[model samples]
Each structure stands twice: as structure tokens, then as C-alpha cells.
Target: MARKWAGTAIVIYFLILVFMYWYLFNGDTSLPEKWVGTAADPATFLNARELMLSEQYSQIRNFMFFAYNAFDWIVYFFILLFGLSRVFERVAASQSKWRIVQAAVYLFLLSLLSYVVTFPLSYISYNLSKSYHISTQTFSSWMKDGLIDFWVNFGQMVIIVSVLYWLINKSPKKWWFHAWILSIPFFFFMMFIQPVVIDPLYNDFYPLKNKELETEILKLASQADIPAEHVYEVNMAEKTNALNAYVTGIGANSRIVLWDTTLNRLKEKEILVIMAHEMGHYVEKHIYIGIAGYLILTFAGLWLTARLMNSIITRYGKVLKITGIGNLSSLPLFLLVTAMLLFASSPLSNFVSRYQEARADQYAMEMLQDKDSAITMFQELTRSGLSQVNPPLLVKWFRYSHPTMLERIISVENYHTVEK
Candidate 1:
């Protein structure tokens, strides 16, 4: 029996590695060349490209995160699921039919109590933003928003738990296989639905009825030849002074939205540059790329866990008091594995994200074709959000997505570097 299980596990493990290696390293990009050039000065883009090459590990810039922590997300999810399940199962192993129900009830209650504990901390954070004049909302408004965010997050958690429960009761042997199949579409559904159905639940949005601003933005959209209508201005001023402009949703519901603060604070040129940068993301199809990358990462993690979790539970369940491989209580042991991997990779994950951001910035430059506008808008965003402009290299390695202020400046300045 053990030999049979071992063989199955090995096959799954080997196949997973093959699939993952192909997905990550195949690197066939048929998409547009991310144009990365201004209309008038083509040579400038080429020159900047060479400078980018020197700072990068390959054609792809691999700062520490890509090398170090690219797999952290996968690691985290697996650990939390496997580890917590085992712990709770062992702790709640009562013969009563009510044991599982009691455990679930307790878990839900703890979550509520945990909210009570954290609510004060959230309030303090909210008040601090207000004190800094960064937030305009009242405490009552903050609480209301917090509650809404909580409900949304809760809904997601419920979905995950429901699926897990179904797996345990319905088709224990096929759980992992079916879970992966379900996740593929679930991942895309989140990408597709979040902007339209989920985001609007929190904020009030009205069409950009301001003709002057709408016309200016639409003209830019027209240049990009994308069909976007009705700029939506969000009532974000009620929340925070954080300025944002992004294109969200799909098809007819799709549009660019500028937070009120973003519109009010940025000059015409800065706003144009900011909008251009966002348009660049859309035109380059970076959103699809980002989502695809994340899915690949997730699927790889699931494959690893499916290959290992059952083997571990079968061997270790006796010591942990778990009755069977499918025991709900054994999940914590599985979760622990995933968590440990995530913890190990935390120091390097930021690099992958920063690379993505850098590509987006490059795309923005190509679309706007204006260095000055990009600089001002970015600087303003950094300042308005109280974002650290440049931290120690180590600090950024672990934290930031965008490069340091100086790195961004240098990258932009290369465009003016007399063509290398």
C-alpha cells in the first residue's frame, strides 16, 4: 500500500515540476513588443533599452525578489490550509457528532472576537490618516467602510471553506484534482468580476459628467484606440487623500476611474501622464500577463501540495490523533508546510513585483512620450500617499514594488542620455 502511494506521489511530483518549468521558462511572447518608444524619437527608446539591460540580470530584470521569493504566494496558501486543518482537527476530536460543528462554531466565534481586538487598531490607523489630513472621512464613515470590506473578505473565506468541506465529504480521493480544475476558472472569474461587481460595493461612482475633463481623457483614449466611455469619479475623498486612476472592469462596464483626490490634486499634464501610464498597462496587456503569471504560480503550489499532503497525513496522523487521511483535523499539518515555504521566500518576493511595475512604467513612458509629466505625477503620488521614495536596498528588497525614487529618475534620465 505504501509503495503504491509512493509511486502515485512521485508521478504527481515529477509531472508538476515538468509542467511548472515549462510554464515559467517557455517565455514565448507573441503579444505586441510592449512598444516602449515615443512617436518622435525612436532612437531614445533604444538607447534607454541598453541602459535597462545593464541594470538587469537578463533581458528580464531579476532583482532579488525574482531570485528569492517568487514562490511565496504558493507556499503561504498551502501552509495555511494544511496546517490549520490538522491543528483544528486534532484539537476538536470528539466522538460526538457535534464535534465538527462545535469546532466550526468556535472558529467563527474566534474570528468575530479577533475582529473586536483588531477594530481598535484599525480605528487608530484611520484616525492617524485623518490627523495627517490624508483622510477626510469621519470615524463613523470609516467604521461603515470597514464593515463592508469585512463582509467582502468574509464572503471569500466562506467560498474557500465551502469548497474544502465539499472535498472532504464528497470525493476525498479526487479532491485535489478537482480543486485545481475549479481554481483555474475561479481565478479568471475573480479577474473578470472584481472590478465590476466587487469594487462598486464599497464606493459611490458616477459617470465623469465633467465635460472638460471627460473630453480631455476621451481624446487620450481615442489615441490609444480603446473604447472606454464615461470616466467615473469615485467618492474616495470620503476615505483618504490617496490619489488613484485606473482602468477597471471588462467590456461595456469598463472605464477609467480617477479618485476625486487624484483629479483635484494633479495638474493637467500630470493627470495626462498618469492616465497615459494606466492606458499603457491596458495597451500592453500587462493585466492579462499579471493574472496569468499568478495563476501559474498558484497551480504549481497546488500540485506540490496534492502530491505531498496525503502522504504526510497518512504517516503522521496516528501521532497527531487524526483518524484518516481525509480527516478535517489534519489540515493544520498541511498548512504548516505551505506557511514555512512562504516564510522562507518572503525576503525575495518583492523583486518579481517590482519587475512588473518597472515594465508598466516603461510602457507608461512609451504611451505618454513625456518624461516631465511622468516624473511629476509619480512624485506627487509618492508624496500624497506618504510612500517612501527611496529606502535602503534591503528595505526595498523585502517591501516595495516600484523601484526607489533614484532608480526611477535614472531610468527616465536615460531617455535623455544622448543615445548611449
Candidate 2:
């Protein structure tokens, strides 16, 4: 019976994958007819083309990326379903406050094991980035950041898993709903603290040193009604040659951040155009909307997970060596279900994100009123970042949060129709 149910579960999981793929691939992917001059400049177009990976390089890189993801997923599923988690639970069973200790130990082990298993792929990726002239960080600096990330993630998982199990024990049948409710505040708290507390751990941040540039950026923010008082500069050159800027945090914590490399590399006009894009995110309230969308998805995902868990536990409780949902040993099973759900929902999440990004791009073009600068800024970004002009359709659906650089350039080039 357990074998039968497991087969059913596998079938259902694959069916969901099939549906997601179908939905994502069926979308219209053609460029607009009005986007005529997007790549009309021979020099800019050739520069963008040069930034793209060679056919052979792209194949190898894409293969490595896909293989790494597949390997990671397999390792996770094997560890969880093959009873490694149960082994960890048994190791902590003799302790006082065993459940809490078990949760902590299990999570720590899980995180450590994941990192260890995935490190080879990560190392390869790092080498690939360096070979492509993307990364600037030394191996030692990379390892340091990796170590910091491990501890940070371990601590975070311990807190979250502890709360999750506590809620499960408190209301075995309705814990999913309760956990969903609790996660709303927890999610916001993480966002609120991330820029101030978490980010500074990895790199140094300072107020933007270019006073004239900062003044101009603030003026742009004012024009966008973003309520931003200052711009920040992060030491991204220490890690990567790539340039980036972003809007982060909420309310008083809200600020625009630029990579120091961006300041050094882009002209004043180009930098202001980038600032306008960041300000666009703020003015459009993408953060708040993103949070709301996440919460809704979390609610649905948790509810589905609960249903799936109950069914699985009923059929394979003894076979999987788990008693019930509230059991501390059930963490791996719970995680497996949640991870699968999240993976299956990637297209939906990416769709929303792409929409938000497109809107922000449009907003930036309107606010800057400098189509030439916007186009040049994007071209510069594409060259510096080694971004693909156009990724394959499935890649864009599954992985891309922003429109392809080609799509973005075309949209801005044909701004009048895009705004409509």
C-alpha cells in the first residue's frame, strides 16, 4: 500500500511539473514589430553580441548549471527520503529537551551536508565566473563569504524549523494555517533587518562618496517621489567585476544602493539613469506588492503541503520511519514536499517578477525622459555583466526575473508603445 501511494505521489509530482512547463512554454515570446531601432546601431549591437557566450561556451556553462541543479535536488531528496534525517533524530533522542535539540541538530546537519555536497559545483561555478572575467574575489575571500553564509543560513533555519515544529505540536491538524499566519510577520522582519544587519556582514557599505552624483540621484528620487534621502555604495568590486544597483528595505530602512564599480565605470548620466530605475522600484511599491504576492503563495503552498503530508504519512508512516506531521523527524519529509511545490510554482513567481521589472523599466524611462541614456545604460550593463541578449524560452520562464536585455532595450527603444 505504501509502495502504491509512493507511486501515486511521484506521478502527481511529475504531472504538476508537466503542467508548469506547458503553461510557461505556451506564452508569446516574439519581439514587438515596433522595436525596429533597438539594435539598429551597428556598434552597440555588435558590442552586445560580443558579450554573449560563444556557442560552445554557452553549451558547456548551461550544462554545468543544469547538472548542478539536478545533482543538488537529487542529493536533497535522497537524504530526506532515505532516512538520514531519521538517523539524526535518533542521535538526539537520548538528550533532555530532545525534540528541540533534535530539530537544531538535524537542521545544522542538513545545512552542512547540503553545503558540502554542493561545494564542488559551487567551486566550478566560481572558476567559470572568474574565467569569464566576472568574479574578482580570491579563493580565500570566497571561502570566507561561504563560511559566513553557512552559519547565517544555519541560524536562520534553526529558528524557522523550531517555530515550525512548535506550531505543529501545538495544533497538529491546523498547524499549516498557523505557520502560514506566523510566516507573514517573520518574512517582513527578515526583509526589514536584511539590509541593516545581514548585508553588512558580507560587505562594507558606506554613503555614496560622490556628493554631486548623490545630489543628482536625490533629485531624481524627488522627481519620482521615492522619499529617499541618501544613496549608498557597496564594495561589490571586492567580489565581482559586474556592476549592479538595487532598492532595498522598507519605510525608514529604505535606500538605494549602487556598486562602487558602477560609479567608477558609468558616466554621470548613465548612473542617474540607473538610479531612476532603482527609484522606479520604490515609487511603484514593488516590494510591498512582492511581499503580498509571496504571502498569498505561501498560504496556498502550505495548505497543499499539509494535505499531501497527511496523505503520505497515512500510507507510508512506518516505511518512511515517521510517525506523524508533528514528529521532529518529519522535517525532511515536510521540506521535500515544500521544495517540490516551490519548484513547480517557479513560472508563476517569475511571471509576476518579470512584470514588475518591466514596469520599473518603463517607469525609469518616463522619469529620466532620456531614451538615449536609458538605452546606453542598458548596453553598458549588458557588456559589463556578460548578460545574454536573449535566453532560450524555457530558461527565461524558469530563471529570468527581468526581461532579457534585448527585450528591455527594445521596450525602451519603442517607449511610446510600451507605455501604452
Candidate 3:
């Protein structure tokens, strides 16, 4: 009877999710009416449109993205339902450290298995990017990066699983709160070190070489009350032609980084406009705000995960081959529930991101008072990145971290400055 009830609950939950998906995606077919700015030439717009929204390339890419996501969920479910995770746990059960070694070994095996299962889809995605001329990474270089990424993830997973199991065994009832508190410092530490440490592992970064451009950017930064220091440029030309710039790190590690492609392709005015936008993130303290929001979400997610996992294990521990909530063998169940929770919360998280991005755009426009440059910068961004001007409403709600290109262009076109 309990199993029947659990099955019914599962069915209802998925039914609701399916309905929400349908509601979000149904009958939403809108495109931007026009482009903005003096540089928005018809030829450029047409080419960008063809690249972004054409049935041949962009549509295929979008479909592949959706299919790949579905495939990932399917794989996870297969691992869980077929007792594969249990089999891995048994293989590692005799390891030392009283479950610490077991947890590490289990996570290592799980990570390796996941990589093997997903490698085909990963390869397809890369090949598609290459075929579309969006990726400049050679196959060999891509494989090298993939290996590096796998090892990094494996190391991180080992640490995370070990800590989580420790917490679980130490205080099963309060581990969620403890984990939440512990995660705050670790999260900030990662953010602080990412620009200086992790990023360099993948790409080469250098101080922006153009003194003239750097001087102009520093002046703009000073005006915005952002710290005027060195601007960094990354060597991304070897990987792709996408134009991007951003502010990363905090305090001493904080700086603006521009893709070399942006410097090579855009005018000085456009680059400054992009720089101003990145500075807006710092000036407005969006990073700190984002971190706070993430912490809150993490707390809630952890708390809920604890409750659900406890209940599920209490009811069906033997059936699922999980000894208890504290057992490292239950990691797959924990992951499954966490994935579902995060997937459901994606819209809310994306909304916050998009809101901050819009605020940064407004701040940049007001500071620069160069609507033409802002407009043209986005036009170039859409063109160079082959970004959709207006994606489906569902995609915009869930996937987009910034306003759609059309939305941004229209906002700039309609923005009116008030006299101070």
C-alpha cells in the first residue's frame, strides 16, 4: 500500500511538471519586429537572423540541447532504478576509513560512469558546434579540455561527497543546516579564487595590452566609482569568435576581463560600452547579492532534500538497497531528488539573473549616455554569437540569464534619459 501511494505521488508530481511545461511552451511564437541603432544595417540583421533563427542550424542546435537534457535525465533515472549505484557501492564497500574511502570510491566510479555514458552526447554537441563554425577548438584540444574538466570534477566530487557523508553520520537530523553554513564559506572561497586560480587552468589571461583603450576604460570606471585598475584580456580566439567581457572575483582578485575577440572585432566606443556594463555589476554589488540569494536557495534546497530523503529511506530503504540516509550508498537517491528540486527552481533563479542583467544594462546606458553604442554593441553580440533575437517564451523563462537580444534592443530604443 505504501509503495502504491508512493507511485501515485510520483505520477502526480510528474503530471504537474508536464502541465507546467506545456503551459510555458504552448503558442509562444514571437520575434523582434526590428533592430535598433545606426549600425543596425539590414545586411547584418539578415545574416544574424539567418544564423540565429534559421531552420537549418539554430533550430537544430536548440533541438539538440533539449534532447541532450532529456537524455541526461533518462541516464540518471536508469542508474537509480536499475540498482547500478547500489552495485557500485557494494564494489567499494570494503574500502578503508569507515565509509570515507567508500564514499570517495563510489563517487569516483559514479563520475567515471557518468562521463562514459554522456561522452557520446558531449561529442555530438562539440561536433555540431564545429560544423556550425561556432567553435574554433580542434578535436584534440577539445579532448584535452574534456579530460581536464573530468579530473577537476572528479576531485571536487570526492571532497563534496566525503564532507556530506561526514555531516550525515555526525548529525543526521541537523546535517542540512550544518552543510548550509559550511557551504557559505566554501562558496565565497571558490568565487574569490576562481579568477586567479581555476580560470588560468583552462585559458591564458593577460593584462589588456591596448594602453589607449585601457586608459579610456579606467576613466569610465572612475566615473562610475568602480576601482580603476588593470583590465585583463583572455585569449579566446583559439576557441571561438564570440565577443564577451565580464567582471570577476572580489577585492584584490577583482578586475574586468574582455575576450580578445571583442578587442579585435568591436570599435572602441562599443568596447567601452561593454566595459561599463561589466562595471555596473561591481558598482551595484550584484555579485554579493547573487551570493546571498544562492545561499538562501541552498539552505532551502538542503532542508527539503533532507526531509524527502529521510522519509523515502525510512519507507523503502531495503527496496532501494540504501542502508539509511547517512549511508554513502544513497548518494544516487540524493542526487536524483536534488536534480528535480533544482530543475523546478530554474525559472526563479534565471529570473533573478535576468533582472540583474537588465539593471546592469540600464546602469551602463545611463552612465555612458551612448544609446547608439549600447545598441550597436548588442547587435554585434547577437551577430557574433549567433544568438536568437527572440527565443520562445519558455526558453526565455528558463534558459536565458539575460534579456533576449530583441528585448534589450527595444529597451534601449525606448529608454529616455531624465534631467538630473
Candidate with top TM-score is 3
What is the per-residue lDDT of model 1 for residues 149-210, given as tens digits with 9 covering 90 to 100? 77776666557655765675677767766777788777767767877788888888888767
Candidate with more favorable, higher lDDT: 1 or 3: 3
> 276 in model 1: Cα distance from truth in Å?
1.0
Off by over 4 Å in 3: 1-28, 32-44, 48-56, 417-420
Question: What is each predicted model's overall lDDT from 0 to 1?
Answer: 0.60, 0.77, 0.79
The residue pairs found clashing in candidate 2 are none
TM-score of each: 0.68, 0.87, 0.89
Using TM-score, rank the candidates from best to worst: 3, 2, 1
Candidate 2, TM-score vs. the true structure? 0.87
Given candidate 3, what's the lDDT at residue 411?
Answer: 79
Error of 2 at 189 (Å): 1.0
lDDT of 2 by residue, 100-141 (tens): 677777777777778898999899988988887778999999
Candidate 3 least-lDDT 10 residues: 33-42
The TM-score obtained by model 1 is 0.68
